[model samples]
Target: MNKPWSESWFDAYAPERFEAFTPSHVWAVLGLIVCALLLWLTRGVIRSHKSVSEGIRWFLMAVLFLSEVTLNIWYVTQRIWDAQTSLPLELCSVTLLLSILMLFFRSRWLYPIILFAGIGGALQAVLTPNLAYAFPHYRFIHFFVAHSGIILAALYMTWIEGLKPTWKSVGGAMLFLNGLALIVWIVDTALGANYMFLAGKPSTPSILDVLGAYPAYILAEEVIALLFFSLMMLLFEVLPGGRLYARSGTYKKTY
Candidate 1:
């Protein structure tokens, strides 16, 4: 039986019709690749033209901000808005807001946070989306756009704006994440929500599934996050451009 499009798009807690790693997943992966390539290819142009770069950055920020607003509105209109899951407490949700701040102010302090969180969290979300809707669905489109936009913003800052992360940034990000995790843990305990997946691994099969179980997996996630942050810092160090390397002094405002 053919399912109604409205049912698929608006239904809360809809069952997964398309399995993971299927054609839909393949298309999502391809879309990410295209987004990455487009951002990389435009790096030189962004570097050469400050006005164009600012315009692009602002546009991306606006899209992310507006998409989130629209998503909340959709949830409300559908009468599915609940404190448990509707709150913007998830890592990707928080990072989307951080990405907006980073673009709006070009603050160096927020750069590492966005880069680490965006690459580690947002990239993973893209690779293994925990979504129910399929292609052409509003939720599907919003999820990919939001996740891909985050990655693009991070790469744009690093490769185009010449922002680089330092060893200190690795420590800062680890500390910040631990603090945020603690807060999320408390919220999850209170609301029985799974923000940041700290409460439990997702129902969908994910990299988290192989990490172990429950409390043990939470510890594993902490270790993984630190390692991911370190690897990201190393990437910036080894990249070709001198500007990509971490400078040894205080951060000065670039914007």
Candidate 2:
């Protein structure tokens, strides 16, 4: 029997569950990385052509926005909309919303937060996704596409818009994350929800599995986040090659 259109599109319990390190997962990861590399490689061309750059930015914004909206619609359609888990309180979800704003406004203030926390959070979600559905499922495609869009938003601002993030931006991002986590914690307590995995580690096998148990892993995550954000600064801002690019005056400062 053929499933109804709604069931075909929004079924929450798809037969194939996402398995990390599977061929499909690996290909998706590599594909996103290639896109990022292509953007960097063609930065000059993109900068020279304003219309093309704007179009790409708008495209990313649309993808990110639609992915998020459709995921919520799926949740509601599947009758799985719980206040605890259905809300957009997860790290990547929050970053996805911010990424949209970052692209639209080209706000320098939002750049560092997205550059550090947005990329870091989204990258973790990409590597060890906590998803229920596998390839070709709406949730699976939505999960990866939304996370990838968050990553590309940061890259677009940096490689295309030339918005530079300073070392202090690392601390800024950490502080912002901590503040957001605090708010999420309060919400989790009130709703008995585990948004951001604050109540406990995720059910899936993730980096948190090796970190430690319960509250201890939360502390460990802070250290891990710091290290990752610092590495981003080194790679994107402090590297000698990137310094040369900055000195060349190819990047027009907009904000």
Candidate 3:
């Protein structure tokens, strides 16, 4: 007999995760590398001036974000609109949420970089074979439109709107995300679910193990995240206060 969704969800993910790299992880890492390159290319695109409609930008972004969230919620609640045996691929929700946060304020080139990351990341999930084993619904929104929707929104905002990141923004984002990671890690330790994959060696011996063991890996992640945030902040330093922010000395915005 087929497994119940609730029982399947818990069985699929409730165990402590160690060496957790799956095919999906391979795609996620590959996507990260590709998006990093795209981010660099986007840097040049963002620096050049452009003209676009803010209304369209907001409309598209709103639609993408709403659709992704709604589909995920429906899946989790098992409303049966398109139910699956399990709803274990909650990672997209977190990634898209962060991408959406980036889009919420930035109005220009910043959008596309974030969008590319969101889209690339989402697509990776769809293409990853592990997803099919994850849940039937993954074949639907999680793999395709939901992800494309996010990437397109991010790209629309970054390419057309010209979004830039500030030190303050980076600092806040890093602080919040890292703090949550810590809490989740703690909970994973207690519950043995490794909800965030922070408990031990990932499915593969990743860069984290190179850092050391548990607490050490934790520290390393903190340092790396801070460095990443700092790097993002430096981009804003080099960037001219966008024309709008220049007049106001507030990192001018387009939308």
lDDT of 3 at 174: 56
Q: What TM-score does prediction 1 earn?
A: 0.91
Give the clashing pairs for model 2: none
Evaluated at residue 52, the lDDT of candidate 2 is 91
* Positional deviation of residue 96's Cα in model 3 after best superposition, in angstroms: 1.4
Candidate number that wins on TM-score, 2 or 3: 2
- Displacement of the residue 26 alpha carbon in candidate 3, Å: 10
| Candidate 1 lDDT by residue in tens digits, 115-196 | 8876789888888778777776778878888988888888878777777788888888888788888999899999989998
Question: 1 or 2: which has the higher lDDT?
Answer: 2
lDDT for every model? 0.81, 0.86, 0.50
If scored against the real structure, what TM-score would every candidate get? 0.91, 0.92, 0.50
Ranking by TM-score: 2, 1, 3
> Residue by residue across 1-255, what tens digits does model 3's lDDT show?
666655654343333332225554455455645754664565555445343244544555576577666655655665443212223323455656555565566544333334333343454444442333332233332444456556556545544555544445545555555665777666666666555456565454445557787768768766765675565455545665533332343333444
| Candidate 1 segments exceeding 4 Å error | 1-8, 11-18, 242-244, 247-255
- Give model 2's TM-score versus the native structure: 0.92
Q: State residue 76's C-alpha deviation in candidate 3, in Å.
A: 6.0
Candidate that scores best on lDDT: 2
User: What is the descending lDDT order?
Assistant: 2, 1, 3
